[model samples]
Target: MAAFNLTPSDPSTFILNGIPGLEAAHIWISIPFSTFYVISLLGNFTILFVVSKEQTLHKPMFQLLCMLALTDIGMSSCVVPKALCIFWFRSKGITVDGCLTQLFFFNTAMTVESAILVTMAFDRYIAICDPLRYATILTNAQIAKLGLLGLIRAVLLVLPEPLLLRRLPFCPNRVIPHTYCEHMAVVKMSCGDTRVNRTYGLVTTFVVIMLDLTLIGLSYGLIIRAVLRISSKKAHRKALNTCTAHVCVMLMFYTPFLFSTLTHRYGQYIAAHVHILLANLYLLVPPMLNPIIYGVKTKELRDKVGKYTCRM
Candidate 1:
């Protein structure tokens, strides 16, 4: 155990546990995680390619979808391949700097995804509620600027995390009991006082993710109220239909996140494997499903995909 601790002469390295107690079954476990990784990679890449090429699909909603696809690709790329190396190749050694890099990118992608969803909700709000000004409001330039801001905000907010983490003194237990580097999971392994890490993590979640979710909820609230005033059921349905893909994505993103956070904080009585599994799912599920949800629900994307693939 002493060998794992940081000494004046020791190199900072971390051993990632593929599934802690389930090491013997890692070959089996990697199958599903790897399946989701491949699905998310191909699915999101297709969405990006399709939207970029289809002139008819050029709009605020589709633009936001592209941003989501980028984050999905990024987040999955940060964790998946290295995780496979651990599970399949039995190579779990990662430099502390390498682990921190993975953590930064993963968290940044998550924050940006949340912000993009909020922007998408706003886009839907205008298209459904204020059709006449939707163009003037979410112009291509404006949408591009919003997308850039989402990325900038995430980078700035998550930058401090790795820097702060680097300052901590890690104990001999340098083994992470999960596949990938998560913000809280890494901090929990430190022998140093983790109050700052945990508190800062909570504050950031509330400020960014919670606030984004709140705004998305408000946007939908207004959307529903506006949708309800229509005298015709057909109009109401049409207005609500535009938001179905985004709603499914929000559920896919938030449900796992909430469950993982709850398990991390309150599930001491729960098995470590359970917490680790939920944490992995929290990052994996959204990316894999977001593209499929949009591709299936949005007729424009679906037809464009079919058109593009048929040509190939």
Candidate 2:
């Protein structure tokens, strides 16, 4: 047998381990994964189509919802196809460049989604707390600016991750034990010191999660206070009802996110397959659920979707 010649400096490809110890079940696993991907695509596209077509749904709230739907679609699309390929075809080999590209886009989508949620929270705050200035505060131009800012921020923050990974000399063991090239997993495969990589990753995670969640919480707190100030019970219900979809979406996004983040960092005792499974679910579940949540909770969107289905 010829001696292995690949070195740390010239590592070419990484093999993704899709749910280790469950190799026989991969094809079965692809069933639900593909199902979720289909649902996410159909649901989010329907939202975009409905929002664009309807005149009355063109408000600031729906505008932000459109942004959120776009982010969800991007986020799921970034990972699911490669994952399905892994599970169905056993095509787990990904070039270094390809893995880095996946890392950049996936992280970018996640960061942008967080920013979009924060913006949504702010929209709700303005609509309920200061209804008079909602129009002036979040004009079409302003919403466009906010969306652009989010994309820029996400790109800037995630750009460094892939660049940093590119500089690292990866070890010969290139098998990553997850469906996708998650930042920390790829970092762990590096032969060089990854202190900077780990530090920067943690710092960026904190910057995005801490800042965004704090702002969201503060917005909701003020929203609650304002709702309480409304003397009529009917007014209170009306104001809170508008926030239901957003609140549910936020919870769905953050709960799995925080879990996956914490487990990646500190869950040494946890099973690897469990961690990987949840990591996959973290990407899959939110996109699948966001449109459904909004469709059920928002009357205008629900009614339009009902009409569209009936026509179909």
The C-alpha TM-scores of every prediction are: 0.94, 0.96
Residue by residue across 1-312, what tens digits does model 1's lDDT show?
343343322357887877778889889989999999989999999998888887888888888889899988998899889888888887777888999999999999888888888999999999999999988999988999998999999999999999999999887767778888888888987888888888888898778877898999999999999988999999988899989988988888887887887777777888998778777776788889888899999988999999878988
Q: Model 1 lDDT vs. the true structure?
A: 0.86
Query: What are the lDDT figures for the candidates, one per model?
Result: 0.86, 0.90
Candidate 2 clash pair list: none
Candidate 2 global lDDT: 0.90
Q: Candidate 2: which stretches are off by over 4 Å?
A: 1-10
Give the TM-score comparing model 2 with the true structure, all chains together: 0.96
* Predicted structure with the largest lDDT when compared to the true one: 2
Question: How far is each candidate from the true structure, as Cα RMSD in Å?
Answer: 2.9, 2.8
